[model samples]
Target: MMPQSFETFNNIVNSSPVLTDRFSALVQDTISAAREQHGVDLTIEDCTAIAELRNATLGATLDRDELDRQMLELSSLSDSKLKADIAAGDQEAMAVALQKVNAGKEVVHYERSSDDRARRISMARELGIATPPPVQDDLRSRAEKIELLQEVKNPAQRVALARKWGLL
Candidate 1:
């Protein structure tokens, strides 16, 4: 059985506007089935209430606008003007930037507490792309082949694509 005091989880499931009663009921039934299969001591009442909570969250997901807004807010906090301020060496900007950065960190901590490294590498990889490398390989023929392959439209065209791209 799931934890009794999954307060946030409860709130998410209960309060979502998009989750219909029927869908919520189905999810509750599924949870109950899993519990019963595992010999969990969950009561019918627990499933009913948890189903309501879960429904609320699921319902909210039906609205794409809300999801988009939330994604925008998250991205804004993580990779917005605040990061620029920090890069420019401004102390006041750095303070504000740190707050934005910390806010993003807090969200990540809560949402992905179980898989910390998963998000770290992705974020680092994205940020690394904007920074220029030390050298510019202008005369590299390998880079040209890779670029040509990237432009190819068909699967067959790409099937025989060469691997000679950059300094090996």
Candidate 2:
């Protein structure tokens, strides 16, 4: 048998994709505090994890907008891969491809931040920490591969991200 509240939370998460970290934190914090107040032996790790999840989810939402903007810039500046491939035999095409490949590569880096944010969110949530909505598990799961993912946007995000990655 599962805890009713836990199951309720799962259902809420599954159904809502727009819950923000602030909201999730409020919910989780309230529940955890209640549990603690009532004599449920909660550890520092548990409290830390929930706090981290809330922070990570919030960070991911903030980064998502920036990532989307960067991606748009990359798309506007880079030659389409298909066009580059078609022009492969032409020196001009090759040049274009090279330029696009280089330019787009930089823009592609936006994923690093987004991925980092996602990973932090996922890890925190998975550990029974509360998380905000708009959390992308795929991003979080593979965040380790991204170099820029570790950059913290704010003090809260920084602490949460560190805890999510076990850096703190």
Query: Residue by residue across 51-99, what tens digits does model 2's lDDT show?
Result: 3333444444434344323322332223233343433445565554444
- What lDDT is obtained when candidate 2 is compared to the true structure? 0.44
lDDT of 1 by residue, 1-168 (tens): 556666656555467644445455655654464455443343433443443334444543334344223323433233543445545656676555444333455556466765655555454434332343435556757667677777989866575444223223
Distance (Å) between predicted and true CA of 10, model 2?
2.8
- With candidate 2 superimposed using the best TM-score fit, by how many Å does residue 148's alpha carbon deviate from the native? 77
Model 1 lDDT, residue 43, Cα: 45
- After superposing candidate 1 on the true structure, give the runs of residues whose Cα lies further than 4 Å from its correct spot: 1-64, 75-123, 129-136, 140-166
| Clash totals for all candidate models | 8, 3
lDDT of each structure?
0.48, 0.44
